[model samples]
Target: MREILVRNTDLSEATPILAVTEASLAEVLAGLGQSAGNWCAVNDFSGRPSSCLLIPSAEGSGATVLFGVEETGLPHPFALGAIVGSLPKGDYSLADGFPDPEQAALGFALSAYRFEQYVTPSRKIRRLGVGKDVDLDRIGIVLDGVKLARDLINTPANDLGPEELAAAVAALFEKHGGAGRVVVGEDLLDENFPMVHAVGRASSRAPRIADFTWGEASNPKVTLVGKGVIFDTGGLNLKPGSSMSLMKKDMGGSANVLGLASMIMAAKLPVRLRVIVPCVENAVSGNAFRPGDILSSRKGLSVEIGNTDAEGRLILGDALALADEESPDLMIDMATLTGAARVALGPDLPPYYTHDEGLAEDIAVMAEAAADPLWRLPLWQPYMKYLDSKVADINHINTSGAGFAGSITAALFLSRFVENTESWIHFDIFGWTPADKPGKPAGGEAQGIRCLFDLISERYSSAQ
Candidate 1:
């Protein structure tokens, strides 16, 4: 992981060096004289993603750093990734003022992350020798949580079924000393998680509800529910081949929730944490639930299955209902629920829905601070009637045929089950990156985890 901290001293113990753009390379080096070493003259040549050089102590008293960007503005995230890995293992401090240390820290930490769970020979990484000001330990903790999420989402569906997902949750509980419970198979029917069972009945892996409790019970309660559809074959209402290609990441919501939970537990926040994952695999079997089927939910609401492909909302409804029963101080749910959300806001930004205006504003603040961007989408009350059904209490799919505001409708469906909660927020995330970016590669990404972690930290820190 990367370490970043505010430096207070101007250390004169190091070599003198100079960093210059291609246009000013000669003039900068000539003016600095022999006190700067031959290698001290680093270039800011365009086209370099992140490149740097280390000048020897012979001709210099202090090192000069040059960044390779077209404009003289805030440095890009991960700009120091390649340099951090290659710098000699020695104590080094930032010489100049940095406007954004968090972004720089994230870049360094994420660069060290490698998914080697199944590797024959584990990869080795060197410790980043940073100055005392840098809190590298905190950076490592955050990266570890992110890597956990990515590894879970990237695993094949065969190896990561509902049972396996539950087991993973159990591992977290055992590691953090939290209490975990899993209700599977017929137990779902007995416990009145009928909708969870119905949607999962088509698959060989039984549907289950994985719950975990942590922190002081007397503290303010926070409930997090994530849709853990391991693989979505679209059940009876199937998806096209391209859509099925990325269905393995349908469980990204679960991975993200677990990641955020890990951060809270590791940081020892002063809030009671409860994570509820409705784990299932939406597959097609002889017993698959079809369109027009009416399934009873944990909240006693009967939902008409207008479309089986819209199964994420069905399972989440039951989990949210159970979360609402606790009447937690705050309730948050995340899912890769709709393509329309991505089409409207692009893959880089996820749309979030919340009833509490202040809570949403706070989340936006934290999102900006953490650099894990998110956007707000309306939970329009006008569209509530779109989900109305004649035979059942509500329709699972919108009947308007044109499918307007897909993300809002999904959030509206979830809203029905969370009436009593003081604050409720829902996130529709892409979960997977189509291409690579600094720190975040083109694979399973931990969306919304950092922002939520920041929010929790701020809230509990204030209480302390």
Candidate 2:
């Protein structure tokens, strides 16, 4: 973790100076009993991306900072990142009040994340300070979990295979005193997790289902399942080179579920929590399952592989079946599942599916409040026929029928595996920000995580 957090004190003499726009700077200078004319003049101050101005103080100890943001407001999360990354290594506090202190602080923490495992950093440590009102302890916990998720997704498959991914989750489980187990390799075949095994057997790393449980046994159960394709080669159908470049992030769903689970356990929510991740790597080999091949799922459903690239749902099918067997009060599954979903909605907006209107409404509301945006797409039972298979019970990918609504069809496939659970939702997420934006970086991200955290907090915290 980078030293992104800057701690501020209340002492008047030790207050760090901030240089805003000429107009705003005049008022702040006057309040401090200092002349605005003494400050260095910054001529071009357009509120744009990565804009900054440094005005020297009389003592020349260090320059005060003036960051330009869009006239509309701070670009949020991303803008704060650019600011922190550009600043020198030191603790500098804002002389004036920030419009949204919480968001600004959160953005600073997020920008400090770095995945530096292979090589050590040569650059000196950079530290930052926040305003007195910001809650550093709480922000550290949240950002640590979020960074853990991004690091897991950002790591390459060779270093972070199915077993390694399970180990990451187990660390969180142990940290929270939760129970966790990993059922590996051939055990998947013996335990009736055929879909999970079929999708991963081509790879040397092997596939497994990682299960974790926490909280009291008698409490209302909330189960989360994530599609943990550590690396996706698109199997026999094969993805184009351009499409395969970022496939290491296919396990982003598992990373996100573990992130949210960390939040739930850290807060000590009353509900019993269960996290199921079917970790795998869909690789191409002679023995790899090909298009038109049929595989029986643990849920007793036979699925035909219309496109071998559509393997996320195959592993998720087995995990969902296992989660559904427990019949938790609520079950949610997240996956970086389909390209069609990315076409319908872009990378930033995660599309979710749910049959329960009330649960959907709650998720949407909480998502907005947490600033983790999500859009709800209908299950649209009419699209279910698109996945109908002539030889097998169902098709993994729709070939021709209802050419549209691919995301809905994929969600519908996983929906079959989940029975007895009245409240079930599936999230099709990009898990990567293509470009830098307020708060979100250009690399791996945890979409809908904060929203899920807020939803769990509201329901479970209130019950306790």
Candidate 3:
């Protein structure tokens, strides 16, 4: 929510932001004249992507800024993000050479984001003047969504436990004039969400399932479920210091879904939206669920616990089962489910699973368009065998297998609870960025929400 725009300002009065490519560097330098050209050469400015230079006027005052773009291919949506940190605090406008000025403005706003809930920001980023052609409203909506997700994920567990997480969802729905409800503690057992209750019963804060609904009931039904484990101690299977350091981000999936819901509501997309978040804390206590313990699920299937750390999929299974019963046109579940996915595709690109081939192809296209990348991994029915349990209907994880396809097996386990829904997709995301990059910083990030929002808008909005 940092101020990113100086509204109603004429572009001619603002400093120009010139986006230069290696091929266009000389032409751009010539346009700026001798002193600027010599400054560029002396500074060894080769117009490399993300490289920037500040041009000085004859009076030795700031005149214009030169930003570098790629020499070939379409302009990156986030290319302008690189200049957010370097630019002096002032008002500026995109010059003629910049591509997709609207996107550039968005990148500038996103780059200004900082998780300042605990500490104040050191400095403010330069604000940009809004051009006539830019869709300022749309940009504002997207920024609000992204900031909400980042804030939720960045908060520490002590301030954002299961009850607090549920409260956040309620406040969001209320803001949008939607209906919100929560089934907490033992009420989950009365409501048949056994897996959610069992996994979280050990925590003193108590477990709950938060639900939010919006739009006309006659519209196409789109259900979203997210894993909301507030903090994971790995249950009876405790994690080491290094592995448990960032367990506060266990609810990132829920945060991301809330973010997506914000965009859908803000845009007034014509779809009946339902969001489900199973809020829990996988803590260790005398009553904590242990490995090899058998628990019944909401879908009437028995699940034998293989490892307590794999509790993300367990909570999601029950939520998906409930969502499936609604037979929504599209059912999507997001979770920070496995490290195996990180090993396969790294942290930036999240892998999704779905039985619908056409949906997968469409999502890939939208992901690229939104600059949020996703890889489609098959449900791979053959891997279902790895989750087989001799005493129960399924094992929470494939403990006996050589850990070859951990992410796939986790997806397969959740897939069992989603038989009623044909259009279902599961996202296994690593919510942390690991390091700072342009608009994204080294903390909790919003992964697939933007791309998913684009896909949802295309599928449902066109019908209206």
Candidate 4:
């Protein structure tokens, strides 16, 4: 939350970011005079969509940025994204040529993010001067939330274990003047978070649940449940080294939940917001929960552990059941749970599951508007047969094994725990950027939360 997006600036002194399309390119070069035209030709700057040309200022040192916009995707929101990381360290302002400046500014702030804790980054501070059309307050708040999630997800498990994850939730609630606490260690079993305790029992780090609430009690209720597996060693059924490399990001769901909560509370949205995070580390030890162990849930459902690696759902099941007890107006759970979700929609577009058609349509519309990507996969009750267990009420993982619609089955498993909530959405997010993209860098990412935030804001805007 360091003030990265600068609001006020000496407009005359700032470097101008002149956005151009092929249609506008000629007029721009002509307006700059023959000398500027010569510069463009000599430099081979044709103003293609991805191409950027920097023209040295005749009166001063730093250059004016000439950015190309794709004509096909008119008003591409993130067109200014590349400038964040590419532009030289200085004050920059977007010229009036671009449409959707609000979204463009938001994209710029998001693209500006860097996880620089472990090592000093080479780049210096670069600030954007977004004029009156953009809401700097909203941009700053959303960016802070997104930054929190990315930072938490980027941090390794060695520094951010189960205890640390709980602490982070406590810190968020504290910042927003909300009251909350965590139940940790053997106390979790007594508190009825048996599955949570079972998952983290093997690790030295204690398993726990973090619950916090904000806003007026009488307002519309929105409860968020996030899967907080601080690190996944996959318990007894360990993952190969390649798969284990990103286990630190398993808590991304919790990270995103806290991030979204931060935005809601900071904006002072008129809704009762309750966040529940089941924090655990699925580690290997003599005492780890084994396959075929029928673990009891907070909802009174019995879950037969099909694989120790499918530990995220176990933790989420307890949390979802706990959240559903009150039957909040909306209940949403986020998890970096399934590789199948990544396979189905790739890394960028996370798949969401919702039984309610109206809610699904609203989410889809808002996701598009917010520029936060999501694809809907059915709750498909017919596929619920895949989860049946002879020994227990349900099996935690699909008995059909991998590629048997693993993401769908995982959502189906979570759905069984949630009986009371009519409006519940499940987000199976990968939560990592495999490579660098414009607004998203190569590391931990914040997914689905922004779209959900917009949806919530609209639903409860008039409420107190």
Candidate 5:
């Protein structure tokens, strides 16, 4: 992770980063003297939001960075991210009048993130010196979780298959002194995770379900399930070349859950955390589960494969069922499950579904506060009919009603396996940032985990 520190350093020794708004730009420029003020005027620096300008110091060894932020509306958590790559490699401090200096420090650290597994990074991100008000430890923990998720999602399937994904979870648990168990291959069948086994039967690597436990078991149980399809070839229903290109990110949901787990453990929240990841690769082969085949799930509900591309929900169905058996105080399953969700909310905003109105409201408020965007899409019980299967208990994908409300239908399908939990919510996330934005670059992104972590922390922390 990039360095974000709360250091007491003299202003003269470090470059200053001034956060300017449209109304404050003139006053800030006037403070810099006539030469710098004239330079700002000559450059036509009007303090447009997300814009950055660099002014050479009198010594010519360091520089003063001007970052533009909006005067009103929601706080831009990543406003300072624009300067991460543009600034020279040196220590920098936020000048007075900067809004939300803590978030700016986080933005700088996040923007420095680069997936350097296969290739080395060409340049280093400049470090930031934050004030005493900034919680450096909290920022470091959050950045560590976000970077962990990004690194997992960004890795290619060749190196990060089902076994490797399980290993990642085990390593995390080991790091935190938690216990974890992974059941793989025929053990999935032996353990009655038929849906997980069936969906992953065709892959060269074996399928697995990793269960990680942490915190006191007596505390409020918060269980998280993630869809870990390492690669989706669309099975017998092959996707087009364009659609299959980024299939390596199919396991983004599991990556996100692990990331959230990291945050919870780091914060030492007062809750028993259980994470279930159904790892698989929906590949096409002779043994690949085909359409019209009926598979019995861990919940005892029979599922008929409607479309092989919709295999994410099938694996999650078993995982959710297993989690439901424990009757946790709160249960959440996140997946890069549907193109329909992406179409409805786009890549930046992920849509979540839940029957609980109170939980939905809390999530909405926390999402805005945490700057992790989420939209609540209704469960719409009426859409459950679309998943009807004449031969089996349910169809994995809804084939009725011209495919309208696809994301809602997908959530309903998973909801069938989760009957015991009242606080069950499902997140259908895109998990990929198609374009570069202020704190988030165009790569694997952790969509809703931060908000979820905030919600979990608040809910359980108050009980203590």
Candidate 6:
């Protein structure tokens, strides 16, 4: 992932990839000499959003890259990422003109990402010289975290089922001096993760929950819960071809949480970190739990399965209940839980639900700083009536068949399982970038990880 960035290169021999904004275009062109200036005029390169113009050098083998951007005045933070796809195989340096070189460098790395696990990676030689001011090690950690989430989400479901995902989590924690165990198959029921077993028992792969912790015991306790629906076939209510096409990414929440966890541990943050992920595949079988089934939860709430497709919340209900037992300093859960969230905010901005106003405010601050889009949706206590059921403590989805306020209602459903924590936040993330943007490609994207990392670090920093 850091292949695009380099620390050392011969500047005199290497071609410079200049990020030219409208404000600096004239001076930049003048410095490039008359021949290159004439090339720009004929090409009509006026420094538009993603425009690029290559100026040949005295040596025909090399060329200077003039990448267009609006810089600080630009609407998108990663507009400079345009050069990643446009540049040819060569050694290049981002010479100047970006207000924030670190963000500009990060943008280059983001656009350089490609999910090439199934095929051979590109062997073309392309290296960038990130200036001295940028922290190369920090950027590398962030890139690796993003790559981990994207790779897990992009892999096919057959290769990434519940058992495999549990193994991945165990290996990750072990790598960072943390230890964890997974209660697999029928043992989940024995471990009181009944909802997890109920959702995954239909599949051949045994379902499991990965519970782990790291950092000093006396430090601030931070717990993270991610819904790991490896593949959601909507259970017996089976979705249409289009709806099920991307079900492999249903476990994206777990993938993203793991990415954030990787950053925290790699940085050696001074905090006690706990991660709880219930990995399950919502498949179909003759013995699969039916629509009317009332599932027992770890929290002791009987959840009536109003719709089999609403399996994420049921499993999360159990997982969140388990996490809240410790009443950690802060608890956060992420899930690709509802289509209603997508309809309301689209794919770019995930809606977060949190009752703690101070935490919400910090999230807002970090989100903008990280250029990771996140929005807040209310708990709307009045909507709790929509989840009421005569047969059980609560229904796992909107009780009304018409499906009004679906995202808010899904959040309200999870709220019931979390009561002990002083501050808890829920992220209903889309997790996939539907279309390619400046720094974001169209495949599995990591949402909220960057912003949340910054938030957590600030909250528990040694300086604090």
Residue-level lDDT of model 2, residues 1-464, one tens digit each, is 42466566532233253434434645654654443344433345442344665555567655566665444456554466666666665556655655456666677667666667778964744455567787776666677668878888889988999989989888888899999789988999899999999999999888889999998999999999999999898898888899899999999999999888887887788989999999999998888998889999999999999888899999999999999998999998999999898999989999999999998999988887667889999998888888888998999777675567889889999999988899999999999988866677678998998888878778777876
* lDDT (Cα, tens digit) per residue for candidate 6, span 1-464: 77777764444456777777777888988987887888889999887766788888766655788877666544467766766777777777877544567787788789888888889988665677767888888888888889899999999998998988988898899999998888899898888999999999999888889999999899999998998999999999999999999999999999999999999999888989999999999999987999999989999999898889999998999999999998999999999999999999999999999999999999998999999999999999999999999999999888877889999999999999998998999999998988878779889989999999888888899444
Model 3 C-alpha lDDT per residue in residues 1-464, reported as the tens digit of each score: 53686553644466788888898989989989999999998999988877889898999777888888876532578778867777776678776646777777877887778888789776655778766778888778888999999899999999999999999999988888899799999999999999999999999999999988998999999998999999999999999989999999999999999999999999999999999999999999999999999999999999999999999999998999999998999999999999999999999999999999999999999998888989999888888899989999999898666887999999999999998899999999988889878778779899999898889988988878
Clash pairs, model 6 backbone: none
Candidate 6 has what TM-score? 0.97
lDDT of 6: 0.88
RMSD for each of the candidates: 4.2, 2.7, 1.7, 1.6, 1.6, 1.5
Residue 276's lDDT in candidate 6: 93
Per-residue C-alpha lDDT of model 5 across residues 74-181, encoded as one tens digit per residue: 147876776677777767888765788777787778777888888977565466787887888888888889999999999999999999999999999888888989
Clashing pairs in 5: none
The TM-score measured for candidate 3 stands at 0.96
TM-score of each: 0.87, 0.92, 0.96, 0.97, 0.97, 0.97
Model 4 ranges off by over 4 Å: 8-12, 71-75, 121-123, 401-403
lDDT of 1 by residue, 1-464 (tens): 32332223434343221224555555655764664435543332332335556555454432544444323533565565555555554445443443244455566557555556577643343333234545656776788789889889989898999999999988997899899799999999999899999989889899999999998899999888889999999988899998899898999999999988888888888999999999999999999998998999999999999989999999999999999997999899999999989999998899999989999999898888777889999999999988999999999877888889889999999999997898999999989878766667677889888888888788776986
For candidate 4, give the lDDT: 0.87
Instruction: State the weakest 10-residue window (summed lDDT) of model 4.
Output: 1-10
Candidate 2's clash total is 11
Clashing pairs in 3: none
True-structure lDDT of candidate 2:
0.81
